[model samples]
Target chain A: METLFYDYVVPCVCAFLACVGFTLMFNIHGMGKLIAGVGGALSWLVYLLAGSTIFAAFLAAVAIGVFAEIMSRVRLCPVTGYVLVALLPLVPGGGIYYAMRHCVAGETQRFLSTLLHTFGMAAALAVGAMLASSVFRAMFPRLRRTGKG
Target chain B: MDYDKLLNMAAELGYQLMYSGAEIYRVEESARRLLYAYGLENPEVFAIPNCVIVSVDTPEGHPITRMRRVPPHGTDIELLERCNGLCRRLCAAPPPIEEAQALIAALPEDEPRYSPRGVLLGYGVAPAFFAPLFGGGLADLVSAFLCGSAVGVCLLYGGRFIGANGFFRTAVSSALASLLAMALVAVGVGESVDVVTISTLMVLVPGVALTNAMREIMAGDTFSGLSRTADAILVASAIALGAAAGQALGGFF
Candidate 1:
């Protein structure tokens, strides 16, 4: 567990940066930084736990969307602000880099697969937010009552 | 209802708002109040710095709203400072909504509501890079990298308007920024830029935001939170493209 934490440190920090950056970008108010940081970490955890990287990516995105809504309600911070941070853990920077590297190396098959993987990950993350929100509504009767409550 | 509080909120989030953009001022004020009242934070706006400012009167049988001119470009450091001052005042004596509405209605017709187009977009992108800093692992890094690429694709066309350059130029610029970022990472200097700063900087590229924005726009509202989301996606895509270009260059050696 200790080793896992140490290994995960880099991604968590990146997630934190993503969250803070989102808050700064959108000018979210009151606890924006904190919300983003926690949200990013949570998203990263989702990614880590899921069996497949793609599934994990999707779960993280959805988690962020739902969590953002929850933060907006519970913390009185901006949902978009939280979403921005939460989604940070899924940006796909390394995948793109890998794909490009392969492409330059004349490894066309590897490059294409990586490219597909990169975009697929993004799509999953983007749609995941909407799906998570729906699932939350289904599970929590109280949430549906307030219409974003 | 507390304009100063709203302004402070905007400032804290790094929104470059103009004092003269009263319509946006009103919208932002309303958003601030409503978000608090409804218990929602960072609710996306339909349009920023609304082009029109309206004053509704119910003196007759039916209430009607009248909008007047609120000029743009009056936003200055002075106004930002005033907002800071006002935030302090509001903290001391928060006003009622009715009073707040009246105050909003009383603002000079010449005041325009102006907001920097992508300020929120920029702020939104930080988490992708920052997650790793907080103990997120290779999974998180993978997420950031992929998300960055999608962001690059989104920015291919949308950035020209923001940068006032052509789409190709914007696309190339996005590629360039990512290239620079990759170089930083490859030479063992990625530590200096750090994951958070890189994500924050890339978030402004409109990569992820663009996808959300298009979806929202298609649903109905032109300037909704979703649209801002699309802008975010494109920005991210641009950054990723640049990074990919740089990585490819590095792999050559």
Candidate 2:
């Protein structure tokens, strides 16, 4: 039980709080903040359960994309802020740092590998979220019955 | 209705949306829909990342064009929401041109904003929690909080000293975060330099740009997407370069 709490619950809570913090910077307020926080936690949980690989980040991005879309429908706002903020945790800051370290330390092989991995991680996130949001909008042709397009 | 007023009003709305970091298609579509609502037979709305251009034909077939050059900006979801809501309302029942223009103009000031201090606190708290996600312990969390705040200070107040250039500003903040993380670990206040540094660096990542860039491409705005993709790459390189410089500087310490 303790291991599960430490491994899953703790990290998910941290992800939630971290996303709430980011909401302040991006000027999201009211229910949008809570929505963004939940989206972030959901993404982190998915990322962890999928095994924290590059593919894991892709799945997480898809989850966030769908989550944000639903929230946007519920609130009738744009999905840009939630998806942008929630995806930050998986953006590979460590990969970039390690790549920089390797490059500076003259480890060409490690630097190249890290750099490529970082690029892959970023690409996966972009494609995953983009695909999910686009497909969702397509499936639900009407954003609003009121013709609020 | 003064067609010139209508043209400028739509352009102004687009400008405000762009300033709030809206998607390019949102800006264009909103402006086009607004003009269409006002009974303009044909309207052309175009926007790149930093500029909004709106052209329309007056009732007499005279062409009127208005352009707004938006400044570099951060995302403000509240303002974006307000502008979008206002646009929808106007489109549903076209308002008087003067009244609509006033509403659009008031958007930037009318929206609520977190004070600078609160935003700085946000900067600190994010990295503090991010440390744990990176497998950091309590001490590393504290170290990250302090280092993140330092980067926040640089971002919020050091603008004049660091210049308004996004690349330089991000680089300086990245360097500051890494250097502070190293110092905190050295002083025995942190467990892992990597975790703390990475957490703080999270604040400087280009994730928003990447997502928005991909979104624009998906929406078929390839020109803006490519430009934003270039921006994301530049910012990433800046972070890498800044961290490298910070580490080298730390070697001397």
Candidate 3:
């Protein structure tokens, strides 16, 4: 239980709070803020459950995409804010930092590896979220139109 | 109906959408749909990342094109939702051009905005929480909060001093965050320099650009997508470079 709390619950709560902070900076008003925060927690939880690999980030992005789409449909707002904010935790800041440290320390081999991994993680996230959003939209076209209406 | 007025209005709407960081296709599609609602059959609408162009015929074989250059902008979801809503309403009813224009003009005025203090609180709170995600303990979280707040002050209030260049500004903020994190850790306030620095750097990451770039590519706007992809890479490099400079500066301690 302690392990689960440390590994899953704490991180997701942090993610949720972090995304709420982002919503303020992005000026997401009204119900959109809560939706974005929940999306963030959901994505982080998914990422943790999927084992925190590049593929995990991909799965997390897919989760965020679908969740954001559903939230947008329910709220009748655009999905941009939720997806963007929720995906922040998975954007490879650590990879970039490690890469920079390696580069600065003259470890060219390590730097290159870290840089490529960072790129891979980012690509995985973008592609995953986009694919999920597109599939969701295709699957529920009439529903989306009704929501838009 | 004055075609010239209509042309300007549609182009202006597109401009507002782009400024609010709507996707490329959304801008083009919204303008095109608005023109269609106004009974124009062949309106040509095109938008790149920084520019929007709309052309319409005045029913007498005369063509009028209006192009607006969008300035560099941060994403404003409130404004974007408002623009989307107004666009839909305009398309639904084909409001009088002047009235629509008035509505569009009113968008930025009455939209919600957080106070500067609140935005600063956001900048601090996000990194503070991010530190825990990065394996920081309570001390590191407080350290990250301070570093994040200092960088936030630099970004929110030091625009003129930092220069208007996005790359330079990001670099400066990253450097400040890292340097402050290192200073705090050195002074025994933080457990891990790595955790606080990385946490502070999270706010400066190019996640928005990356996601928007992918969305553009998925929507078949390869031009905008490529440009945004390049932007994301640039900002990432800027953060990397800036953090390195700050760490190097902190290495003296």
The best candidate in terms of lDDT: 2
Q: DockQ ranking from best to worst?
A: 2, 3, 1
Report the lDDT tens digits of candidate 1 across residue range B1-253: 3433443343332232223222233344543443354233343332343233222222243333323232323223223323433433443454664554344333333233223434333333443455354333454454444445444434434455545443344455445445544554556534433352244334433434533443344335556544355445554555456555544554575
DockQ for model 1 equals 0.29
Residue A38, candidate 1: C-alpha displacement in angstroms: 0.6
- List model 2 lDDT by residue over B26-134, tens digit each: 9999999999899888799999999999998776778878889999999899999999899898999887999999988998987899999999999999999999999
Error of 2 at B7 (Å): 1.1
Give the Cα lDDT of each candidate. 0.49, 0.92, 0.91
Give the least accurate 10-residue stretch of model 2 chain A, judged by summed lDDT: A140-149
Query: Looking at model 3 chain A, which ten-residue stretch has the lowest summed lDDT?
Result: A140-149
Between prediction 2 and prediction 3, the one with superior lDDT is: 2
- Tens digit per residue, CA lDDT, model 1, A1-149: 88776656655655566565455433344465677778877888778778547888888777787887776667532244456446755666556556655776789999899989977876787668866765765776444322121
Best by DockQ: 2
1 or 2, which is superior by TM-score?
Answer: 2
Off by over 4 Å in 2: A147-149
lDDT at B104, model 2? 89
- Interface RMSD of each candidate, angstroms, one decimal: 9.7, 1.0, 2.0
Each predicted complex: what DockQ? Answer: 0.29, 0.82, 0.67
